[model samples]
Target: MPNAVEPPSASPTRLEEAYALLADASGAPWRPLAGGTDLMVQMTGGIGEPPERVLDIWAVNELRGIGVDADAIVIGALTTYTELRRSPVVAEFVPALVEAAATIGAAQIQNRGTLGGNVVNASPAGDTLPVLLALGAEMVLGSAHGERTVHADDFWPSYRTTARRDDELLVRVRIPLALGRQVRFRKIGTRRAQAISKVVMAIAWHSSADDGPWADVRLALGSVAATTVRARTTEAAIEGKRPTRQTADAAVEALTAELEPIDDVRSTADYRRLVAGRVLHRLIRDEGGW
Candidate 1:
């Protein structure tokens, strides 16, 4: 809000020529910029020490498209939260994405903030992260050389750090055809909407027989660990078991054991663990663990 970075050198075309120049340049330490939804605000608030040489990527047409690919629904890095929330393809293909998109920030923030920024920011409390993790999404990184894909599950190496190399720009998030096996996204914030999540969970899977098993169960949780994590143990416990009361209870137990939540300002470890159990119960018992 305070600082609208006056480009150290003006970009003639604002978007196209900037990337073209940066693309052709050698070892440019330019900060590729976007909608300025997150980055600008951070810089203004003194969270960012100073502005680096800026390379604007926000206005690139190639980085703003969202559609279904051969095997996945691809959301471009520059695609805003509001864009995703209103996208029919995303709604049909990855409904959980819509759910997460709707809760990102206020309308203004959602209008400017992008999916790529969210992924790269790597906040544990990030609303969409758990959903992306559960859906087994992949990120496509682009640069002068080419592109590479990394799975969301294994993307983050530490708190706020990802496998994304510095020079590479995140191009798009790819959600595979296996996404909709069964999906439910849940968030626990101070209020219904517009509040940062205390806990966010996304659980996806397929139910077996009438009361038999649940297979391909994937559970991703946020705001409880250094980074978002998969509830593997809980998922395995109920994957091939009957979806009865007993199995549901055991699933909660497994989930609790798998997490290592720390005390934070919004919630405590005990509270988060308890909420995790309850969320598992609701997801598995009532909604058929999808």
Candidate 2:
């Protein structure tokens, strides 16, 4: 009898070759690794496991960098939380981006965990997501054939997953250059920094064209529904109308209806609903929605 060929072994060399082979062999599934923050935790705790080899792509330099273009800021997939948190551009131009980055676990987690990994992890509590949603960001996906640009709005087709194909890689995130948009980001956590948000909100909008009303509002929320959502009804209620207490109250009502909070260890569904709306109200009122 002919000798049976041995399956791929779980070695570093095998891990390195998996990507090269899978780039052509689409039939096999390959688990890509980086800091392995979430993956390692899941694997160690038996959250899940795979029979195939893992591709350690952390060393790929192409996936790491931060730069700004004429129309947008580009963040490479491998850019870590620490890099983003400490970036001056993040603080000056996208303060919400910095706020969100600062809240992703502790320093160690920030150093290793990457933005791409966070997006791929697909958690409702992912800190950067609400801001990205509000920013109208684009997700750039790549495969052997070429690259495809997907709006962040369209990328999350469902919970804990994105529109990334079986054979594609999430390469980078592109954020549109926003001007004079009074942005505000807030998170309610167990303590303060380095904690998962029970409630999080990011609002990007200008005060008004001529002190008339809220203009170009994009209010995104997290841990509210199945995925982070822009509060359209609330936005419509205030758009083109002078920012006032009455409008704020109406916006809160709209927000309450927009989100369908669920019960979880973090908080009660009812509490999440009330707080989510309140966060919107506060952000608009104090954080410059007008």
Candidate 3:
């Protein structure tokens, strides 16, 4: 007979209560449970026992809203993908994020999966990660002591690891508004709807006019490196250049050089590299009408 799984020792519904529990050093380390879309899966699938202490923050009102400040759109960590799809602000300023969010899962997963959970899970294949990296988003973490912000580029320093401290909660994400930039997001997976991506990418750029040169190009990719990475070399190569096939090919060369994809069950490193280039080429062609 199989052994029964153990339940979390404590479940706190309020933010303050959760913090106090985390601040207590005498107890076991508490894993903050947001939507449990990812954590629950890990726990059920893993060989070891589930976490002994879980801080359930699903009902914490402080972590569930979307607002706009002077320069950026502030999204509470608990904001669901469904909320993102419905948000006019997200549609207007960060449509790529909306696009990425729509591709996460079916309606049920979209309803329960929070943005914070995705960020904290820190999967290299996470769909929204490339969008966040391209948009230059910032993560806001909070603890009983205080709050500190980390840029998205620096958030994931290694594979499946984030800069978030054990005692800190990912409170929210702030995305700076890039009003007139042309943004694109694409995910190449085995199947369209619910499959993990082979290669996921997001690209954003500014241009003076419809036919002008690309400026301030920002390109980011997931499943191509240890962490979702901004393709700085590729961006630099494409910057100030018109979106032509030659330019796109050159950008791809630079991008291929920068990425270090590995062979996994989902895709081979060569296939990922090839698809990434193809996607970038198509994006450039479509954007330029070439």
Top-lDDT structure, candidate number: 3
Give one digit per residue, the lDDT tens place, for model 3 in 1-290.
Answer: 23356566566667777778888888778888888888887777773446768888988889989889999999999999999999998998888989999988778999999999999999999999989888889999998888999999899999899999878899999998766787889999887677788999999888878867998888999998888888899999999999888898998899888878999898899999888988998888888798
Worst lDDT window (10 residues) for model 2?
A: 2-11
lDDT of 2 by residue, 1-290 (tens): 22233224322333224335447564456666767888767655556544254556787778888999898889998899999988887677787888788888889999999999988777787778888988888999877667899997887778777888766777799988867676678888898756778888887777645345768888888887777777788778877766667777988888888778889988988998898877767765664344
Question: What lDDT would each prediction earn against the true structure?
Answer: 0.80, 0.77, 0.88
Clashing pairs in 3: none
Candidate 3: regions farther than 4 A off: 1-3, 47-49
lDDT (0-100) at residue 169 of candidate 2?
Answer: 71
Q: Per-residue lDDT for 251 in model 2? A: 89
TM-score to true structure, per model: 0.89, 0.88, 0.95
Worst 10 residues of 1 by lDDT: 7-16
| lDDT preference between candidates 1 and 2, better one | 1
lDDT of 3: 0.88
lDDT of 1 by residue, 1-290 (tens): 45556545333234445545556546545666777766676777756445556666766777888888789888889899999988999898788889888987789989988998888878888888998899889999876667899999789878888997656778899988763277889888888767887789998776545455667888899999999888888888878776678888998889888888999889999999999889878766776444
The candidate maximizing TM-score is 3
